[model samples]
Target: MTSLLKQPVVDAINGQVVEEFTASLQYTAIALYFDSETLPQLSGFFHLQAQEEHMHAMKLLNYITEAGGQPIVPATKPVKNHFESVEEAVALALNQELKVTEQINSLVSVAVRENDYLTQQFLQWFVTEQLEEVSSMSDLLNIVRRAGKDLFRIEDWLVQNPHEAAAGGAA
Candidate 1:
């Protein structure tokens, strides 16, 4: 396999690292908003998402270093706007996950074009992660859509379906 640390591939990988960290920051902000608004279950869900994003960032950072590339320290941007409702929050989460999935695919395309097999291998994990993320977000959206205006019903739905939360960690 060609060394991915060389030139363009290194830059691409570093960019992905930054994006992963940014995703973590965004999800953490959503989590905090849920916590402040007294939605513990939603807060817990986003908190776990934030943790997962951080783990993804670290994984990419480590890969960059292992490939002899300098892992750039990521800068954090403020996440603005609190979600007005569960539906809005879940929709935002789904959109954000979709965005990340696109980013990962783009990166993988770059690696493939550059013939960087090692980078492709490294990105395989992220591809799987994005699949799980999109699926989870979609599932949440479906649940909230079904729950509609009944917040109590939504809470009950969550309580009855504990496996949904468990599946998030499975990714």
Candidate 2:
């Protein structure tokens, strides 16, 4: 099939794939940190996040192939395995989400610039997803800050609010 995506759009999507895969690895590292700290809820939450990020990368890869563009499976960037505190770890996650949001916006811009209506439409899901991602990460960061020394409070909160906990890991 002829490629429906412009070269620039394909390139941007490939870059996003790298970001998503890196996020998956970072979340895995965070999960491991939580596990080493004996925090089951936090570990579980981050593990789930890692899976979600992996799925996100796969989604982008599938989209690229379905759009008749060549998909590049790139190596992930390095992830920080050690964190001093839960707040610091959550802050790192929040920062990453913010960066990913910007990248997704840039991808949409590229699709628009290239006049790739299909790609633009396809990227809409990611655009909307960023809102939830940022909001969830922001809420989690706030909870982590408020919890402070009471780390178990986060675990308890996660147990109480399963849905919110799944995404943001807190209410």
Per-candidate local distance difference test = 0.79, 0.88
Question: What are the runs in model 2 whose C-alpha is more than 4 Å off?
Answer: 168-171
Candidate 1 structure quality by residue, lDDT tens digits, 35-141: 88777777777888888888888888888777777788778655655777878878888888898889889999988888888889879988887887898789878
Prediction 2 TM-score vs. true: 0.95
Q: Write the per-residue lDDT of candidate 2 for residues 21-112, one digit (tens) a residue.
A: 99999999999999999999888888988988898899999999998999999999999988999999989999999999999999989988
Candidate 1, poorest ten consecutive residues by summed lDDT: 162-171
Best by lDDT: 2
Q: How accurate is candidate 2 locally (lDDT)?
A: 0.88
**Candidate 1 error regions (>4 Å):** 1-4, 168-171
- TM-scores, in order shown? 0.90, 0.95
